[model samples]
Target: MLSEGWAKVYITVEGDSGDIERCCEKKDSHMEDLSLQYVNLEESENLERHRTEGFSSSKALVVRRGAPFRVSLQLEDRTFHPKTDFLRIKVMLGSLYVIIPVTSSKKVSSSSWNAYIDPEGLNLQSPSIFICSPASASVGCYRFQLCVFTQESQKAYAIGKFILLCNPWCREDAVYVPFEDQREEYVQNDSGLLFMGTPMNLVSRPWSFDQYEPGVLEACLNLLQVSPWHQKNTRLDYLNRNNPVYISRVVSAMINSEDDLGVLKGNWSDDFKQGVHPSMWTGSGDILKQWAQSGYSPVKYGQCWVFAAVMCTVMRVLGIPCRVVTNFNSAHDTNANLVIEEYYTETGQKLNVSKDSIWNFHVWVECYMTRRDLGPGMDGWQVLDPTPQERSGGEFCCGPAPVKAIKDRRIDLLYDIPFVYAEVNADVLSVIVSKGRVISYSKDTEKVGSLILTKAIGFPIHQSITGDYKHIKSPTSSLTSRRSTMSGDSTLSRAGSSNGVSVSLTLDRAQVAGEPVCFTVKVINRQNVAKKMKVHFNAQAKEYNHGPSDAFWETHGVIKLAPMEAKVVHQQILPAEYAHVLGDNLINLAVVVEDMDSQERVLASEEFNIASPHLTVQVADSIVPNKVQTASVSFTNPFSHPVSGVLTVAGAGLIQGKVNFRVLSLCPGGRMEQHITFVPSMVGTKMLQASLSLTNISSTIRGFKMVSVHGA
Candidate 1:
């Protein structure tokens, strides 16, 4: 409570390690440092008694990292008299973060307050905060304080203050951060927070889309940013050419900046990460039919390229941006068919293709999405070539294996499908591959070879669709950014072959200790003929503990594999085996892949790991619905514990409010349902959100989703 014409405001900063400071407008400033760490403002200088004619101070001083930065003013209380409808506080964070407007635990009953920043505003690049006091006679010269905290942090970090003055000039000063005209686009007056849209209608696809017009050929430049081909081409050719003519033609035909669709780099989006499968694009359109009939993988001449392009195209067309990636799995034994050969072995012997030594090029795509559904339009990836069967009867079949040593392994050449192949080996003669016949190699293999072409292959459509999608052009290009498995670039000379060969295994880490030990095995093939090999592994422990080891490391399954193929095995060490090895423990691991024809040895190895478990945190059911919305906000602990902490909700005009709850005391691992009743005066269609932390567990962070009121 204060005099008729006087108002008070509070300003605070949490975790102000760097001493974030803000200058106040009023010459006389009052500073209250609640943290007790230090107080910068003297108590007597609290109010700037003399008001400038306009009642405006220089820009309000504020420390960047300081919390609760505030100011108070002396005014005629008559200005805040009756008919006052609402009290509001505006908040803004200089940087980007999800801000939550929270009120002080100490309740002020006489005045009502509404919030500005809503849940939708949380999605903005950076948003401000707003608190509105319900306009009423009790508002008098009340102190309206604004508290803001990041979504990641439960506690308030920055605080601001203002006086609820009844005078008109005083009210204008509170809303000064953003001009009144811009408020519609950036914030709501009642809550002083941003107005983010609804969850189903979240804002994405940059605002630039709104300004796009057909007249601006430069709009075509948008392709340059979304499409990788444009990015590279604009760099190599159009870096200086901003001419309208060039933009029109390039944008009109949508000619990617790099190569044609059939010969593009990769299809995966830039956001793709490990463990996720790449997307595939296939359609029955006329353009796709023409491209697929050309002995290509429907999109490009190379399977890897086609896979990459299709993956990328699907993601882009669906509004997810992506980029092509290129890398060589030199230490990867899982993908040998993609290896490029390297000539001149360690012994100075010309390299050859054997079942045990080979490498081939490969390609795959990746992406990231708000949700885990596959594909843009609920339709996920459909198969064009259903029931695809690999060429049988050889060291290389459906799995990783030598290319030349296998009969009918080349899907492009073996089928009546138009195919292309280049011989990089100087010793490779003419290669004649026929179905059911071992491929015969001659020195003339350097000559360009074309296989029969298969056309009009049909695919079965998957009934299950996931994300939203729109039909665009069928993928008709190949992404070539991935490295060639066969690292060999040597030009072909006279034909000659050697039997000398060598193999090596590279592990992800030489040392690792944990409950689950995952590592990769890199197998290099240094031979000529397609070599069929077997990799065998065994672990040696001190006391021969065998419970979990028998279940996980038993050698019952066959390890038959291709040359240069690497495999990453995730091994979870069981609790029983922990006693056998202590510090610097040694264990033997072996890999053995044999040459199918000669039945000769290829690889053997040893590896080890230090085993231990680490504690981790995770949040469950992040999207919880607000079932009952009355006097008290409530939620059930989906987990098996007595979750105990504060639950919060913001949005749809709730700025400064309070919620009371009765404990349901549900049994452990049981459901306890209850109903909530809020003051009927505060009902609306806007989303009401709340979060209550009931568990002390570090991983107990919760998210309230699908929030709705009882009547609304």
Candidate 2:
């Protein structure tokens, strides 16, 4: 298909070798120059291809082995469809000579083919020849045939050739050109269109790895060809927004209405429903399934995105424009309050969930709903989540009434009132009401009606009321021995007179038979006068039926002060059992007036232990040989408190063995030391626990290390 007049060839010797003579011939328009360097195998026995001019370079063959060797080929680029009609390469060096004939078609695209030299046969004096290209091929890319021969062989020793021809299935877009291009043109070719929608916050150089691979490109082309979307009048924009939801809902509704949609529709297979579930969007899979069976699912239905997507699909089907946005915010919305306790009771599990902890992830969705839901003049811009029935549902809507919304409603009242006390059939006051009107009211004026209140009610009442007016004086009713009101005094309980109602309490854990428990007491003012408030504290003895005579505890101290002026009463419980360690065991403490008129009065409890933690060392195990195979040490905890101690091993190769510890510290540089450490002597695994005699000691502890060795 091509003439020799339009072809040219060039070649040069390559590698560490002498040149082999073989002049290139140029017939008319075809110039075969055999002078340029040709790439030869750097190492013998290896194969390599050589290129010259163009002509889709050809592989080299060792015609004659010498210092320098090269390849020869014919090149042609006249017009686009050009080909070589015939090619032959001859080699001669010293007494060596050979010839090769080539035949080719035009379909092969690569520029070169490999020619190998046999390591055993090729030598400095051996002669070889190779013939390639210029074959009876059509106008297309092709490989040339290569033929090898030697001076002694009459018929061609080896013959090979290749050719390429045009194919209708070739991809024009996938073509690559390595030769000619301007710098500006090259720059413009590399830049692709940038995505403009959405926030392009991150910018970086384009990546080639993400480019469609050969297989992917072929698949895409096949898909496009099958659908013929360009010729079909299909609404792609509407399809993009509505297709997924239509499929999702169809799948969901089918699943919900039938026990087995696959059975109803025989065409459906089990594999198609592998990952599908009734709870489509619930983050927690198990919880959703459980709730789903209950007829009213919580978590699954609460997934705002799922509902948002479904709703968006519905809206689009109805010709409405909308978009979905997802984000996380605190429960309190703006202030980010981190200390609100929310207990979920629907799941029948009572857990005090706190907003302060790290689990405080509040997720919600936003959608463009009707604007009238927001406010006036903003009727069509209401952004909210469709799943409003969820736990933390809907977008944060700070409407016009924000001033009246209190985020922290739990602590609105300083104290909670579990119960309140009131006067009933007491020699007290009475109030009469008629037709929702207070007809009459009266009291014992001087004394308040008998009121029995528990701590729950007393605390809140104390925090609510400071200066009192009349305990039971009323403006209307005549004196009576009973009281009448809308809410009867049925909730009240009789607590006897305030006098002689003495309650002596102590920290049970801090007190033992022979130990002293430190505690404080405050006496508030119930009367107006600066009366001397007599205070007394005594440790009552244990009642024993067969013991000697009963002894009454003597009052340790007393405080006298004016009315309304509170005094701190410090006391302790002293039993005879701890007499040996009473001096150290006595929890010494003094009551300080930390709060004056403060409703919140906190008492401090101090702890005193009689024993201190100390470390004692003992060689746990010894082996038969003086040089032990693996030695181990154990530490025991024997103190009333926790202590931190360091154990160190000084012998060499100490760090080479397997070392483990629970209480000992492991140091570097073979300085085998640990708050705990383990050294294995035998060739077996030993389960060992290292515990230190920990004590809350203020200073460095003294000796007390107990060790016990057990066989592994």
Candidate 3:
């Protein structure tokens, strides 16, 4: 550790080939002629020191490329008198060396290493060594040596060796912003965003973004394949740094399969899964570090929210201002046509095949930057989706879509603005088909992109910014207009003409696992005469990526309705009937009503998900930065057989690295307890997350706890 107010010495020596041997000597030698000896160099003050059993010098020095660094040195019996002795500094990498001459300093500070000396010989102190790395500096470790020479010996003494490493986020090469608050939030890792569950509203829910882990930046660089000596061909290589092209490449590569180094390999399944909860991912740094340590294999199984949250970490670590955004009732406009179509059989069974569908919600990232590549109007927040939903430039990635362009409905803009635009503004059309022919149908124009949101900075609540993306139109206005347009002769002829009958369906309450599902079906007759109708009800549990797999239950009944009158029929499905096939605890129910007298059919359907109980993790006390705290986790095994696996705990500043606990055997229905002790190294809102995995059962349960850490 460097002492306060003490100046360090750094000497630079330059000479011919014959002088190299003299400077390389380890011991000090006294010569009759003028000579330099006792030269020593210490590692930079910021590098972490690891002391060995018998060694005092640092094992290595890690320095970020382009970061301003200082080194301290000392010389025995040799005083660097400005007028008499000439000092030279040689920076050596491999066999190459750059000779730098020592000159008088203009100004010096405690943190600076620039050479500074007094006029009087006795007042003169050691030379202050300051080095500013350029952006072109190759990243790697190098050795530096200092030498001194006099006119008589014509040789320089090599007194010391210093190790220097170049890292990615160097101070001199990265963009410099003027606002302290913005800089701290974007570059300093003070806060970050994490998404949980599915999106429920247009406004983003509050998620803690912790970016200040010690290895986070290093891990991020690893993602980009950036090292001290080599730069690999990643998405980052496609564009210039600090420009929109680079930003677009980064956003696209984040979720796309173009780069295997991408963090998320998306998988949506109830069983044979990994990472059950997005909140269990406490910070980007730890996640990235894990990937690096695992030999750069992409982290297993991530959905939209996970991809977006991790993207926020990488962007912020690279000094790019970023945040996570959520779109509620987001449409997956698979066909590039702003319409999501659903098909049903005459008996009300929903067909499993469709090119377009809508997701409950979708999460993406937005980065702030000046769009020098796109010219004046594009400077600001650009939408970027790490989710590999759509392809751009033959790769699975989206955006850098200018928010301004999205708001203005500039579907022609670069990237995937049209895809993103339809995510919020797409029209949904439900059509009924009988005998392979289209019949009655309805269109809901306001269903998709119902809400767009991001968390408000410095707040624990969601901030709705829907107005910034699209104007929310009245549902009635769009519905009436769409009905009129679809009621044209062409549409009516395509929809088999039948005696006027309308069918609608509604659920009694939210569906839950191990519980009955009850719903109501209503049939209305518009004809003057009474009519008989056949009603069919079917429930199927299907995977999100594929068509309906198996029918869980089915029922059909007959009903008679009076002229211009409506009749309601109620049905209940027991849990045992569908529980076996309920793959992610989700079921799609469809109901169809047919007028027996006219052979006309109407269909209605609904999809619901059942959520499982989550594990619980709690902190024992209030947390202060740099202070240790205890966290306890409790998990109850719901299985009937014994389970055993690993429980892993991780957080950005809460722990240095991931902590793992082993479970030998947990009895059926038994509760497992784990206590973890860690020290919070940063002050802010932080998250501590843990996951319990049972290899025997092939199940994983996750939980998280958020705490505010105050400065010590």
Candidate 4:
């Protein structure tokens, strides 16, 4: 932080340890002004050694335990004589403190703290010291103290303070990641993509994890400190911080304020006036800063993706390899029967008769670590959901459940494997109920766990990890499997066709906002005589996990299908009708064909998202770190009337909290261009994300550009 040797940094956040006040209490010295105590914290050099660049912007010295980082000891107006004086470093976290003596010989321990004078600075006026912490040391804010022992006097002074995190770069650490590239991508990369939309069409939303951004890292550390585990038993929480499994579970529970005072409060309704809308968030910096600034009040309006993305930021900040995963057609089997029941009326109205629901897409986080608790082969990527969908172990948290365990159906394992298993492998029962009586029903096996997606390493594309969570050939019901192999549409997962009459619903695959929504329903009759059927059609906009909001379109009519013939009916709803009711949510479309003569009805439905208009961000293909670069963002209002709001640009390792640009107004179909300059601080591939929030419509439009920062 200093142009000379090093600079002392002080930092504090909400829920920070009490010892920090003591560490920074005072610089009182036993000796006179002739010899003042000074410990220069070499943040840049130590950050490289500790693999803690993610928090470089933080005022606290962020370092991972189990690694040796360098610090310079400077005593004013004093000539150091190694034989006459001895130097020691005292580290304290809350009620726990340890004093490690500085020795000439290097000492490394997996169970205790150690330190030594750097060999290169042995003869220098300001000697550099290398401090080492045990791999099992508790992770949190620590007060650094220096004790100088001389023949004439002994003095201890508060020197500096730091935050300790899990050491993924240390082999002796439980969270150690062996591969360099994997660590760089998972733990170091502060920007990522969160997958959304239906399984048929995936939307990659860029997210700035903002680990290195100012104050974000402090907020993350504060989250761990204020957790229920830490609050209930500080000693136990400190001892358990070494394991990624424990840290992940704690983070999962702390990301959402369900039963505790965590970071985000979950909200799925249309209203988000108390705080920022979940969809408006393009980065974690603002949300985290708000939480820390608001005295740790849970930030309003967060859904699954928001929770998962913030959790990923926290996990990565703690040096755990983490990524976001999205499961399409994700089922929430509340009864644990692994069956999701969806009821429909004979007239094609969806009835919320069952507590179970299938989210069109659900987001969660996956952390990578050695699973020593679950035994061998159970390591690798594990699912840890921050969304408070259900309670596990008396807390509204889920996982630390291994993806391996989920895929192998090892529900007997620890940490809510059954719940995660049901999320991806549940069966759906499409039941047509009439007057409280089941008329016809069919089971769908391929619907759930249709796809599991994560952002690919070093690429913007999505990587399919569905096989990592479920078998390739998941078992299906006999009736459904028979129709599945009948060679119709390979991409479509359909059921209930074997009931002699087949019904299928298809939507215009390339549906977009500001355009007419179109779909077709095809009904086939295999019976010999003419089939007279009452056709029922309906559509409603719905949150991915919640029930439908208001109906956008519906119709009832009579139709006739000739023997052994199929009829297709096309339907379209203008943009004016649905534009008022859509924003990152999906449309639930369903139809029921009732055989009036036979008094039988069949149901078919599909869920799809309307893609929002894209904003374009242009930046140079290659950028130099520490050098200013200009980027332009252009957006054209797609909707009618004038729109106005704030446009925010943010990127971890590139920009600070958020760069805001005000937009007075833009007429319909009018383009707006904004150019901004920023200096990229860190190297490697970093994402520059821009988001436009429209206050008039309460909508957010997002765009991102990946820049390769090659130079130091």
Pick the lDDT winner. Answer: 4
* Lowest lDDT block of 10, candidate 3: 48-57
Per residue, candidate 2 scores C-alpha lDDT tens digits across 588-626 of 121211122321111111112332222333444542222
Off by over 4 Å in 4: 1-3, 6-37, 75-87, 124-126, 150-154, 474-488, 557-559, 625-628, 637-646, 653-670, 679-684, 695-698, 710-712
Candidate 1 residue 249 C-alpha distance from true site, Å: 43
At residue 466, give the lDDT of candidate 4.
78
lDDT of 3 by residue, 433-504 (tens): 878888777776655765566766665455566767887554433223323322331123112223588766
Q: Number of backbone collisions per candidate, in order?
A: 157, 82, 19, 0
For residue 314, give model 2's deviation from the true position in Å.
31
Measured on C-alpha atoms, candidate 3 has an lDDT of 0.59
TM-score of 4: 0.88
Candidate 1 ranges with C-alpha deviation above 4 Å: 1-185, 189-558, 562-669, 677-687, 694-696, 701-712
- Candidate 1 lDDT tens digits, 1-712: 5433232333444346222222111222232221111112111222222111111221222111101222222212122111211122433322212222333332333233334322342422222222333322111112222332121111122232222221111222211222332221111111111101111111110001110111111222233333333555634333322221122222212222122333122232323343221211111111123333442222322233233333333222212222222211101221233223222211112223332221121222222211112212211111111101122222111211112212222333221111111111212222322342323232322111101111011111111110111111223211111001111122122212224223333333323232333333444445443455454444443211111112124231234334544333334334335333432233434334344466444332322334221111121222223432333333444433343444433332222242424344544444333333332222221223343333343221212222222333
Tens digits of lDDT, candidate 4, 1-712: 3456455432222245433333223333454322434567888888777777656767778888888888886666776767656777778787677778888878577788998988764744678888888887777888877766565555566666888888877888877888888888888887889999876556789988887777888888889888889999998887788677888888899999998879999998768888877888888878888999999999997999999999999889887889999998899998999999988777666776689999988999999888888899998888999999889989999989989999999988988999999999999888888889999887887789888889888888888887788777745432234233322444246534645577877775557877787877778897877889898888888878887755678888888888888898888878887777767778888888888887777788877888877789999876998888999999998886788889899887788557999998899899999999999888878899998888777467889999889975
The lDDT-based order of candidates, best leading, equals 4, 3, 1, 2
TM-score for predicted model 1 compared with the true structure: 0.21
Which ten residues in a row are the worst by lDDT in model 2?
Answer: 196-205
- How well does candidate 2 score on lDDT at residue 335? 20
User: lDDT per model, in order?
Assistant: 0.25, 0.24, 0.59, 0.80
Candidate RMSDs in Å, in order, are 25.2, 29.6, 8.5, 5.4
